[model samples]
Target: MKGMFNQFGGQFVPENLKNALDELEKEFNTAVNDVSFIKEYEYYLKYYVGRPNPLYYAENISKDLGGAKIYLKREDLNHTGAHKINNAIGQVLLAKRMGKNKVIAETGAGQHGVATATVAAKFGMKCKIFMGAEDIRHQSLNVKKMKLLGAEVVSVTTGTMTLNDAVSEAIKYWVDNVNDTFYIIGSAVGPHPYPTIVKRFQRIIGDETKIQIMEAEGRMPDYIIAPVGGGSNAIGMFAPFIGDENIKLIGVEAAGLGLKTGKHAATITMKQKGVIHGMYSYVLQDKEGNIKDAYSISSGLDYPGVGPEHAFLDETNNAQYVSVTDMEALDAFLYLTKKEGIVPALESAHAVAYTKKLAHTLQKDKIIVVNMSGRGDKDMDTVLKYLE
Candidate 1:
């Protein structure tokens, strides 16, 4: 049966995992609606994870582009240097409430692993992270960070040795340890409640942006842009503005070279409807329905599937999907670093690359808000190798 997001997400998982998902869904519903639970969550967000970061007006970039006044939602300023911390904190807290003393998660660029480890440490819970072997090589810094924060890092050599494989390994592990362990899904993908749960936690980004933009410009932005892998950060930023009829939501996907190159991860733009990671969404697959390998310079953005919500949004014409090549993303990375003096995660750079194109096509008075999802410090190794 099609669950939430209008015939998109459901428990397309094993029967055992379905039971665990049901329990999680019930607990999440109860906890999210409880006053005490929300208060506790907000408390940790402020005192620990640092909520209400900032909506920075990128005057230099805006002037350089000579079009829309660009504003950046500074999620990079959060404690773990990314918006992933928001979901990590929320899911770990839920695990604690459910009497789970250990948590397991899958990560691509390792930001989510680090976030999960940080929260597990703060909450005194045991943590395990599943990461692809190739991703471990590319994102060693974040891997070390996760390990330093007291996590057991498991390397998955299966599949394409990337995000999709890591997710498979984590799910298999969680199914075996379902009673004592909790799975902290990193993005707004996965089964029904997970997408909803992650969206709720991440919606803070857009909620804060709304208020901050109103305070700064006395109105809503004409566009909100964010990079989409499994679509957590983008959906989180888009959820609050979904009802604003005039506001345009754009999700940028990773196009490794060009669409014709057949190596990118532009699932929403180039793929068909299929089940992946226990959810129905747009996926890159062969004629036999086997998932294909997704390649990108950014480890975090090279996923074969889009979040189910993104699939629904694209179909309903509520959001637009675009692709940026790796070269374009790297160029945007250098541009933002030079102009704004802010280093963006390669994942976020994809959105910046699109913004660089879209902003120049619009009027100078039009406003665009880009969710700067993470800092680039963890991507130093990959970026350096690419530069070399």
Candidate 2:
């Protein structure tokens, strides 16, 4: 699948890793099309990860907004408390099928690390997770969870010490140890096979949402909204609906301090076409084209580049990308907790904040679905410190 997604995705890795990537791509293609493999994956999704997650209508929030009715696609209710598990489970299964006995991954915000660790333990595979030092400090609880699951958590202190740094470190490690180890990328941002593979697994989000929304409203929603970090959740939610021209797809990125403050991760909104993490996409860079450090109160959203597919979507106008500030996200997080008794992940709060802004502009009959990608338990420490 090299140069897939209309030339937007291709393997841009070094010579040493090309063969491994090729092998991965071939195996993934075969696995996805195999009926038995699909059945086994579906079984785990159904029994272990708890498939067909709820689509709950936020009555109080909608009533408060007095415009569009809001429905939450509750991925937060998944076993690992996030949408990351969907991809992790699929990749770990693939790793087992490929006869790999160890799995590795890079994570920010810790949700993906926990999800990866959980699956590795279930399959009895050795797990190693690379996380940014700063993220480790902010998401201490998640570190404990990963450790409890018996995965080695390595703190990466390179380049801004955030998501991008961890990604670089993970890639380096994968390049060196490509024989018996499988690298499970947490998001849609990566080389050819990874973005495609992650998106394929996570597309279950859009597939389920389509059925649930139609049953609930008797029609498809006017818009689908999701937060874009590495673009996994957003791409998953938007993939199934892309062909439906009437349903608008919106991706919200985090504006750390503010967009103009030079401390934001609003990649699609503020970036230009560039390659980072082995795929060409919208990247946060300086005048010299050096990738800049992205900052976001939401650990997951702190990345310098977005997924290649997101860039393609933006380029083709299939979806719109917008941004929400740290303060705006915080307000939405608090508002949801007060109004609906749901505390969303800070990353998810960006989408909720945008929903609040958009709801008031549309008519009351219009419906909007937000991918509540993760719960807030993983964000309590950061939230508490910010609130204090």
Candidate 3:
């Protein structure tokens, strides 16, 4: 298979798992080009997952900012309340096409797990989700939703008991059960084909935004912003616009406390090049190359490594990567809630926070689009604690 992401993405898995990766790549390549497969995927996206999600102009927020006009790509309104379902449904359909009867996935914030479980239930496939024990505790509502959707939620206790550990456990499970199970990775940070596959599946966000923005304003926005954990949503929102030189793409990473405090998940800003979780990317690692634990108030953005394509993009300066603090994201969350009445996911709020800052610096005629990747319903408990 061709190298992933301009030499930034490749399979670095155990020797035993090579064939499975190769097979998955082949099947995904074929499936993407097949008309019937595309049609079926589109059908589900429209009828089941609720496609063509609104691109709403945040007039109140824009007026408050008094600078760039802001528009929100409302992925939060999708069936499962997040952009995750876009990739989840696509991967599940691919698994069914490959004749896999069981699916496995890893999630941190539980949006991905819930999405996977939802698709599995709809398709009558057995599903298991690996999540960190800490995430299971903090994101209890999501865990409950997954279980109610008929998926077995496995709590991982290794390492920091968060996203990174859960991902490692999920990959190990896939390696051990490669034949009959399909592993649906939630982010764009996994091995070869996975980063590519997830990006392609989630790219609908950008594709739709491009058309919707053109129709609404008769031109592309000057900036597109989204939060980057493993970078699926940001990459999805940025891919289609990469060729539009006039459009700037900005990815916001989580600065848990602050970048200067050494307690952030700002991979592109603070990490170095290294391999983790079967892909070569910018990783938060020690001098000995050991992966370090990443911290973020938002579970979805608490990852040590970013997607390989994002690493490449940073290296090539094709897009800009920045960080937002927990306090900044919290302020934006409340600001949007009061100003626009939209409770953005904590992950998405990071982007919103940055957009607000950027809008202050730009002219009023300038436009910015923020991908509201998910809703805040799953984050009420966390938010309430922070508010208190």
Runs in model 2 lying further than 4 Å from the true structure:
none
What is the Å distance of residue 357 in model 1 from its true position? 0.4
After superposing candidate 1 on the true structure, give the runs of residues whose Cα lies further than 4 Å from its correct spot: none
TM-scores, all candidates, are: 0.99, 0.99, 0.99
Number of clashes recorded per candidate: 0, 0, 0
lDDT of each: 0.93, 0.93, 0.94
**Number of clashes found in candidate 3:** 0
Worst 10 residues of 3 by lDDT: 1-10
lDDT of 1 at 112: 92
For 1-388, candidate 2 gives per-residue lDDT tens digits of: 4755775777789988888888888999999999999999999989999999999999999999999999999999999899999999999989998999999999999999999999999999999999999999999999999999999999999888889999999999998899989999999988888998999999999999999998999999999999998999999999899968989999999989998899999999985778888998889999999999999999999998999999889888999999999999999999999999999999999999999999989999999999999999989988888889
Question: lDDT value for candidate 1?
Answer: 0.93
